[model samples]
Target: MKSSTRSLGARNAVLAVVLAIAGLAAQPAAAEERAKDLFGAEKLPTATAPQSFGFYSKGCFAGGVAIPMDGPTWQVMRPSRNRRWGHPAMIATIEQLSRDAAADGWPGLLIGDIAQPRGGPMLTGHASHQIGLDADIWLTPMPDRTMTRAQRETMSATLMVDEKTHLVKDALWTPRHTALLKRAASYPQVERILVNPGIKKKLCDTVKGDRTWLRKIRPFWGHDYHFHMRIGCQPGSPTCKAQEATPDDDGCGKPLAWWFTQEPWRPNKNPDAPKARDVMTMANLPKECRAVLDAPGPASAEAATYHGGAVPVAVAAPEPEAPSLPATTASGTAGLPSAVNAFTATPEVGVPVPRPRPPAK
Candidate 1:
């Protein structure tokens, strides 16, 4: 009986050890699988990874540290060839700016024309900029380049200037380009704005690092031509990690001294000018400008600020209908015959002159 009891006890201990080993082995596999699901393993074939990769942990747009995507296990799926769409919050902000521009008769902002879209897995391991909210606006002057005249006019009107200077033109410091920069500074979703050398100088001088408003703007490489705008990660994304509010020298993954100048341009006398010449925020905006964007196409006089003396066209009233006679009255009048006066009576108009249908082909 003692020998049998010993054998049973030893068998139970062996089984317990085997179960513990199995549990330990299963843990890592489960963790790795979860990581793979979070970050896709492979690069998306057609998509490029995001550029100017930096992150923040606190502040407006970015909530905090982003969970990393595991490239080793997470496989990327090919995205469709449909039109590129941006994050809803980012789009909403851009649209507000555009509407404001149109209302002020400043034309529209050329966002996508020269803007860089965030890349995705198809290209390779996705980088920090992969989230759709980021964009890069070129800092170069608005020369003829390849853009159409209308495009140049539109971009320039929104404080984006492109001139052909012997020296490399910096967009951020130019007085003409201040509107967009200032407006961007006002948006809460923007965590950091990386610009070329000249742009940093301009921003520092313009706002004087009392950077109270410019707190989110940071300096980085690519000074020769374009300025990078980093959009904060939207809610629910795992990869977002916000960096410290102040700038740091950590691996921002940037080029060295690529920009040309450290000097700032002279400050414009009108640093405090409203976003557009005409419209302020809806509350302060002139009543006439408020109605301009809704008027379909551009406004005539009140809408077009360029025309010096043009007055706002009064909102046109709906045309009145020709007086319709009751059937009884019509019969009586016809029977009387003499009731009509040839000289004083008007001819029956078939249809109210169709307001000329505003000229068409």
Candidate 2:
């Protein structure tokens, strides 16, 4: 029996290697190139139509707008990442949240990764945030003065979790943190807020009554220093997809208990773990993304006009030209941001959806 099993395993291993080789042989060079560098692309495609396509991770965005690095109530934390770009609705929401944070105390807010200028998979770090709807806000309080660009790039987020106990480090964590979490959760447009399990536990223990907002404060891995905020599809873009809704429970009981158990921390026993993230191909993306990559650079003046003082204005900084495509209709551009200008030449294909007003207070 043992010999027979060994022979079967050997044959399977040989077959797997052959299949892997065949897969690579079949993929076109364009697909391979996309997997390597599309995510790391620095320049926004020439087209300035603000839109998101497909699901967040498997999708892309075009004509993305930049969130100002320094606002009245917030400072973007990581400038080098060049991830301050997002859909206009997301940008407006962040600005609103920053002011809300200031009203609650703590020297305004410290913001982190928004998305690449045209959203797609990141060059490194994070499997999500491909769409402009996700952002990271540091738990660390922003200082009352303007920070240098260098400071923004190098600063580390203040850790809140205890390594051994997997709980809030009692000394460093404070009630102010709880207050901030509450404020973020209260925003009507926000769909979910991801934090370390420790932070969720802290909320579970301290809060007295009325746990309605707690349902949105989801516990996820590796959010000790900052919380991740996600919004549903922007109103204007019909093709934007929403993630499945969270369960009805607050997630502080059985769901929370699972994270603390030995099972989650154990090494993967299955030798056949699926595949690495780097293996994703252009085929893995929505068909429209090819157009996103091929779209021409905007005219110099038009580019500058769109960016303005919103960001550093690298609009005229000389980007590599994308290879041209046979003319295709703008129908594929159905889902994206509102036009940069009501008069600019971006394709005017679909009607943008209007956002619903908040419930009466």
Candidate 3:
């Protein structure tokens, strides 16, 4: 019996490996087609359109949806220029989450924000939260669990929606918020997740016993306020590459194979320590949240050791040199912010900006 069981396990492992290779073999044209489709659309404005949809041949749809929550339905921020039409599978997931919430008699399952870009280029600047595929969801009690006021505060802080505009305020995590997050890890579309160090530790602990699915995902340092959820998006592909849940790098620099077998999730605490807050211009923030009277975003995720209590990150300046003003040129002024403008022969797409509004009382 033992020999037969061992053989069966070996066969299953082989099958899994074979399937993975086969999947890779089939990704090129599909990936190319996806790239073409993604880039072929209209010149992406600085951002994407509101709630566009993307459909993958493999049966996934991802885009914007306003899910009803405690008060109003949550509205996500979309890029002003480009929007990936969502696939059906993603749509079904949203519908099912709403249905499950309703049937379960919950207040509301608010999908506060999606695809709020924390970092990365090409898709950076102008508007990141603009990507329709990303989402920031509020942490709700597990259907079988209860939520406390502290948990609510943690959720509220973690959710960090602009009370006035209801877009993702920012992404950050704390110890309390981390516990709540482990409960939400079962969603199928989740690819890589970012969180505070303490939260990652708790996740490592909580899933130690049996959350095998957690193994398929990785974690990173998230800015305070919200957790960044990375989802898969590829239209016409039989399978989503980024969608396969995988093991985390255990940024703590330890092997985590025994993580599921351990008692409590013990994530690295040092790297997750809160750093001094960075000052951002109101112009850089989502327009809706600009109304926040005191918009100091949560503490930073990295620390600087100058030893002053929470000092602002210093900007290094160029070394002083003998000053020589630019020699006057015949027809141009030097060293002024360039007044560069693009003049397309045809009509061009312009990025949409949120009109500023008063802060919520």
lDDT of 2 by residue, 1-361 (tens): 9999999999999999999998888776535665426756755433445567778777776655666677788888878787877765566667777787788886778999888766777777877787678899999999888999999888788999986788998888777888788888777677889999888998998876778789899998899999999877765455677777766678789889888887667777886764333666677877766766766544432342222214223242345665433222246653333233212433333223344333445
Backbone clashes in model 2, listed as residue pairs: 46-296, 46-297, 50-336, 50-337, 51-336, 51-337, 52-336
TM-score of each: 0.36, 0.76, 0.34
Best candidate, lDDT:
2
Residue 250 of model 2: what lDDT?
A: 80
Cα RMSDs of all predictions? 24.3, 7.8, 23.9
**Cα TM-score of candidate 1:** 0.36
- Per-residue lDDT of candidate 1, residues 1-361 (tens digit): 9999999999999999999999999886554432112112211111111111113211011100111111111111111211122333444444454444344333334442111122221122223333345544443332323454344334432232232221324433455455555566555666566654445545555554334555555655333344455555543333344444444332122322333333334356798774321221223222222222121221111221111111111222233322211112223432212121111112342101111112223
Task: Decide which is better by TM-score, 1 or 3.
Answer: 1
Winner by TM-score between candidate 3 and candidate 2: 2
**Local error of candidate 3 at 357, Å?**
44
Q: Please provide the root mean square deviation of candidate 3 (C-alpha atoms, Å).
A: 23.9
Which of 2 and 3 is ahead in lDDT?
Answer: 2
lDDT of 3 at 268: 57
Off by over 4 Å in 1: 1-83, 101-106, 112-128, 139-173, 208-211, 247-361
Instruction: Show the lowest summed lDDT stretch of 10 residues, model 1.
Output: 59-68
